[model samples]
Target: MSGLIGKKIGMTSIYSAEGTVAKQIPCTLIQAGPCVVTQVKTTKNDGYEAIQVGFDDKKEKNTPKPLQGHFNKANTTPKRKLVEFQFNKDVELGQEITVGDVFEEGDFVDVVGTSKGKGFQGVVKRHGFHGVGGATHGQHNRQRHPGSIGAASYPARVFKGLKMAGRTGNKRVKIQNLRIVKIYPEQNLILVSGSVPGAKNSYVIIEK
Candidate 1:
C-alpha cells in the first residue's frame, strides 16, 4: 500500500452541500507530503517492497553521522523524519511525492499515529471499571480500588496480565477507513472527515 507521511495541522468544521440544506461536518486538517524518496528496497536486495521517503528539514549539525551519509546519497537536505512506505509501484530515487499524487477527494484512507499520552491512570479511567463500592453503604475508602484481584490461596500467587491501573495512552493507533473530505494541492493540505489519533502537529501516515 502506498501512503504519505503528514502532520496533523488541526481540526475544523465545514458545511456539506448535500440536499437542500447544508450540514456541518467535522474535519481534521493535515499537511501532507512533498516527500522525497530517499531509498528503495527490493525483494532481492532488502527482502521487501518498500520505498523510504524523507520529509521536514533538519540542521546538518543535528543529524546523525550515518544518516547524514544516507541523505547525502539521496541528494537532499537533512530530514527530520524518514519513513518507509510499502508501495507496489516503482519510484526513482530522489523522486518527490505530493499529496495530489496519491490521494484525492472522496478517497478512503487509514491513518496511523501515536495516541496522546495520559500518564498514570486508575482502573476507572483506564479500563472503564466502576468504583469498588459506593461512598455510602458503610464503605470507607475502598472506592476506586481494584478489589480482590486474585484468590487468597487458589494459586498462591497473583495472576499475570491483570488489568490493573498503570500508564495509559501513548501507543500506536490506526483509524481505518477515514474518508478524504477535501484536498488542497496548492497549499499541500488534506482534510479528512472525523478525528484521527495523536495530538495536533504530530505526524500520521495516511494509507490506502
Candidate 2:
C-alpha cells in the first residue's frame, strides 16, 4: 500500500449536504505531507521494495551525523518523522508527495497512529470490566477490584493472558476504512471522516 506520513491537526465536524438535507459529519483533520522522498529500496538492492519519505523539519544540529548525511544525499533538511511505504509509483529523490497527490474526497483510507496514553488503569476502565455489580451486600471498596483471579488448589497460580489492570493506550492503532471528506491542497490538510488515533500534532500514516 502507498502511504504518506502526516500529523494529526485535530478534529472537527462538517456539514455534508445530501440532496436537500444537511448532515453533520465528524472528521479528523490531518496535515498529510509535503513529504520528501529520502530513499527508494528495491528487491535487488535492499531485498524488498519500498519508498521512504520524511516529514516535518528538525534542527540540523540536533540530527546525528549519519542521518544528516542521509538527508543531505536527498537534498532535504533533517526531518522529524521518516516512514516507509510500499509505493508502486516511481519517484526521484527529493520529490515531494503531498496530500492532494495521494488522496481525494470520497476516497477511503487507513490511518495509523499512536493512541493517547491513559497511564496505569484499572480493569473497569482498561478492559471494560463491569466491576462489582452492587454497592450493597458487603461490597465496600471491592467495587473496582478484579475479584478472584485464580482457583484454590487445583490451579494455584493465576493463568497467563487473563484480562487484568495494566498500562493503557499509548499504543499503535490503525483505523481502517476512513473516508476522505475533503482536501485542502494549498494547506496540505486532509479531513478524514470519523475519529483517528493519536493526540493533536502527533504523527500519523495515511494509507491507501
Candidate 3:
C-alpha cells in the first residue's frame, strides 16, 4: 500500500451539516506532503521496486555530510525525513508526489504512531481489576490492593501472564478506518475524523 508522511497538529471539533448532534471527532491536522521522489528502484538495478521520497526542508548547516550526499544526488535541498514505499517500477527520480496524489475526502485510512506514555500505574487503572472490598469490613488501606494471589497449597506461585500494575502506553499503535474529513491540496493538509496516536508534532504514517 502507498502512504504519506505527516506531522500531527493537535485536534479540534467541527460541526456537521445535519441538525442531529454527533460526537465531534478529535483529529490530528497533518501537513501531509509535497514529497519529492529522490530515487526509484527497479528489479534490474536494485533487485526490487520502490520509490524513495523526501519531505520537510532542513537547514543546510544542520544537515550532516552523509545525508547531504543523498540530497545532492537528487539535486534537491536536504529534507528532515526520508522514507521508501513500494510502487510501480516506472516511477521516475525527481518526481513530486503531493498529498493530493494519494488521498481524497471520504477515503478510509490507517494511521500508525506511538501512543502517549503514562508511566507506572496501578492494577485498578492499568488492568481494570476490581480492588479490595469495603472499609467497613476492617479493610484498611488495602482498598486498592490485589486482594489474593491463589490457594495456599494448590498454586503457591502467581500465574504467568497475569495482569498486573506496571508501565503503560508509549508504544506503536494503529487506528484503522479513520474517515478523511477534508483535504486541502493548496496547504497540503489532511483533516481526519478522529483522534490519532502520539503527541502533537509527532510523525505519523497515513496508509490506505
RMSD of model 3, in Å? 2.7
Off by over 4 Å in 2: none
Ordered from best to worst lDDT, the candidate numbers read 2, 1, 3
Cα deviation at 76, candidate 3, in Å, is 2.6
Tens digits of per-residue lDDT, candidate 1, 1-208, equal: 3889999999999999888989999999999988999998988999988899988888999999999999989889888878989887768888889999999899999999999999999999999998888888878998998888878676878889999999999999999999999999988899999998999999998898
lDDT per residue for candidate 3 within 1-208, as digits (tens), equals 2888888888877766656666566666887888888877778999988888888889999999988887888888988888888774455677778889899899999998899999999888888877986787677788788777666876688898877888999999999999999899999999998889999988888888
lDDT, candidate 2, residue 199? 96
Ranking by TM-score: 2, 1, 3
lDDT tens per residue, model 2, 5-62 = 9999999999989999999999999999999999988999999988899999999999
What lDDT does the true structure give each of the candidates? 0.91, 0.92, 0.84
Local error of candidate 1 at 59, Å? Answer: 0.9
TM-score of each: 0.94, 0.97, 0.84
Query: Cα miss at 141, model 2 (Å)?
Result: 1.4
Q: List candidate 3 stretches off by more than 4 Å.
A: 19-25, 44-47, 149-156
Candidate closer to the true structure by lDDT (higher is better), 2 or 3: 2
Error of 2 at 4 (Å): 0.4
